[model samples]
Target: MLSGIENAINSVFKPISDAVSGFVFAEVTVFGVTFPWIVAWLVVAAAAFTVYFGFVQFRAFRLATQIARGQFTRPDEPGEISHFQALSSALSGTVGLGNIAGVGVAVTIGGAGATFWMIICGLLGMCTKFVECTLGVKYREVHADGTVSGGPMHYLRRGIAERFPTAGGRTLGKVLAAGAAVMILFFGIAGGNMFQANQSFAQLRNVTGGDDGFLGGDGAALIFGIVLAVFVGLVIVGGIKSIGAVTSKLVPTMGIVYVVACLIVIGTNITSVPAAFGEILSGAFAPEGVAGGAIGALIVGFQRAAFSNEAGLGSAPIAHSAVRTKHPITEGYVALLEPFVDTVIVCTMTALTVIIAKTQFWTDAKATVAAGGPTPDGVTVTSESFASALPWFPYVLTVAVVLFAVSTIITWGYYGQKAWTYLFGKSMLSERLYHVVFCLFVVVGSVLTLGSVLDFADAVLFLLALFNIIGLYLLAPVVKREMTNYRRRRREGEVVRVK
Candidate 1:
């Protein structure tokens, strides 16, 4: 009966999934390598923003760190959460299963060389984060109660209009913003809620011994989904404040634990460290690992980085906008840390662990692709790597996965709610309905297969990026002006750095 339901659902959604996947995964051959256009577009955007901002990600790195540490924060700032809280909240959304599973997938498909490119993507994406988040805070609406509403919708609609003064231009800006919101709504549910639920549950099932584990039986998913929904539903209600408070703690806890565990495992296998890195470097530059090997790695790296940090997706800005800071640019600076922590640091760590533990596992993706098989599940690859080192590590990973899923679902609920309110007014009914649908999808995701869900969400993410990048291009001058004035104010001693 369950199999019948799963098949029916797939049959119904297959067409829609196929249509979306066409655009999301549309590939173009470059230098004898085929890759999705979305990956190239995002990588180009990241590099462009990095250059346009005068390498703000590098030059302001120190200041950004100081600000995130609350050096520039005041108790009575304009928003609901501290910069650290905001950063953690956003990081909570981005640094979830993707780091564990997605990184493995990238390295698997692209070879060890993909790890090198993934780092580059993260560095370039820092500027992308700065741009979108600066616009998010700059154009955010502060309510009577001191709440904030911002992100691409607020900036694209309002800032884009200012950039394009003509009536038609203004109309186009609103349309683009609305289009992005529509996509955001779907992605928030699919990727943020369901995918996390499904993947996290799968990880749980794995660590528990799969078919024979007490909680790993056929009906375990529904139970896992309900538990996730209950915990997440409680926190998402208080908006960014509630979510921020939870994430500020949760992000650090999980991050420290994961890092420490990886460190121990890597330490246990210290002999292979140099050789693993050698494989990474060689795979990156050598062209014989797989078909279009170096190029394949490059594509996988960029694609995974974008998926992991979501710098260009314009989602982080929503959470960053809620940060309490007198200087809007502070949060932008703080947000630069998002891609770094999510993609640069956490993801790199995961890759290192996997590469070190199971040497032969590095070729899984290339081998699979070369054989015309589907991309393997990253969770399995990552779990096996950890298990190889410490027989008990999968249990730790399972706990981390569940925690990551819970945090992601809660944060995404806010994102979807914000998007929903952007299109429909923030009435009680609208908010409640969005919550209900979001929770329902969490359950659905846990029970269903991921092929269709992933394709649909991936498409939605890229479509929203299209709308968002259009606005970013139009509003680039404004971001420049804001950054200039902000820097000048700091130089002239007009803006005091709060201790």
Candidate 2:
């Protein structure tokens, strides 16, 4: 019966998913390698935003850190969470599985050179996050109950309408906003919720023997999912405040633990570090004769970096929108740090660790994979890299993976909730029902394949960029105007330094 339901779900969605996937993942050959044009679209937007803002990512980074520390924020600000909490919650979403498995894949397939392009993408993505998040806070809605809601859905509608009042105005904005909401709503459930549950359980099962551990028997995944769901349900019931409080601590703890463990592995083989950097730089621009070649490396690096940080995916804005601040740009300033921390720092660590690991472990694994042998997945490669040096680090990795997955799940729950409210009315009953369904997906995600769901989830998220980028383009002038006024006020001593 369960298998039937899973198949049925796939059957219904597969056709639509296939069509969407084709368009979304359409390849354009560059540097003698084919990559999804969507990657190019996102990178172009990041570059454009960075140049338009006069490299605000570099100049405003210090101010961003200050805002995150509450230095420039008034105590009596009118929003749901603090700037720091908002950053934490948003980071929890981006700094999860992508930082681990995704980085490993990029290095393993794209080769060492991919790391160079990855850093470049990370730097540019910071500007993209700044633009969307600033608008997220600027156009948010505060309900009568003191709860605030925002994101691409709000800004695309409110911001776009303000810009094009004489040219179909709100009607056009509503169309784009509605489209983005529906896509993000689905993305939240599949990519955000189910995907997290799936990976977290997979990692747990890896540590504990399959069908041998306490909860590893038949229906183990389902049972584990139920318990996990209950835990997540408990935290999410209180809304953003609840999620924020948990993620604020959880993100920092998980990050420190992972980074420290990575350092231990890297530090053990400290002498190889310089050589690894050399390989990365040379690999990035290798001649066509090289494996994956220059283009392949660049494509791999940019795509992985984009996926890891999710700078312009428009999801972070939802979390940043809830920050307590009189100045929306303050949150924007703080948000620019997300890509740097996620990709530039965390991802770089993962890539270096993988690149520097002894090839002794991959001799047989790569052989098996070369000749119609069983596929050795990237996650396995990552595990082998850690085990090569520390020998006992897999246990530590299991804990980090679970924590990263959990943190992302909870943050995404908030994102999905807001998107849900955008489509369905924001009623108490409506919210409770959404929560119940979300928890149920936690269970479903653990037990099912649902490949179509993954495809659809990925496709729909790019649609977020479609609507979001359009809205950002329309509102760019408004943001520029406000920025000018803010600068003038600061120069005139009208803006106080709360710190």
Per-residue alpha-carbon lDDT of candidate 2 for residues 115-158, written as tens digits (9 for 90 to 100): 88899999999999999999999999989987899998899888
TM-score between candidate 1 and the true structure:
0.95
How far is 393's C-alpha from truth in model 2 (Å)? Answer: 1.6
After superposing candidate 1, which stretches have Cα over 4 Å from the reference?
Answer: 216-219, 359-374
Cα misplacement distance, residue 116 of candidate 1 (Å): 0.6
lDDT of 1 by residue, 440-485 (tens): 8888888887667567887888777888887887888888988998
| Most TM-score-accurate candidate | 2
* Count of steric clashes across candidates, in order: 0, 1
Error of 1 at 422 (Å): 1.0
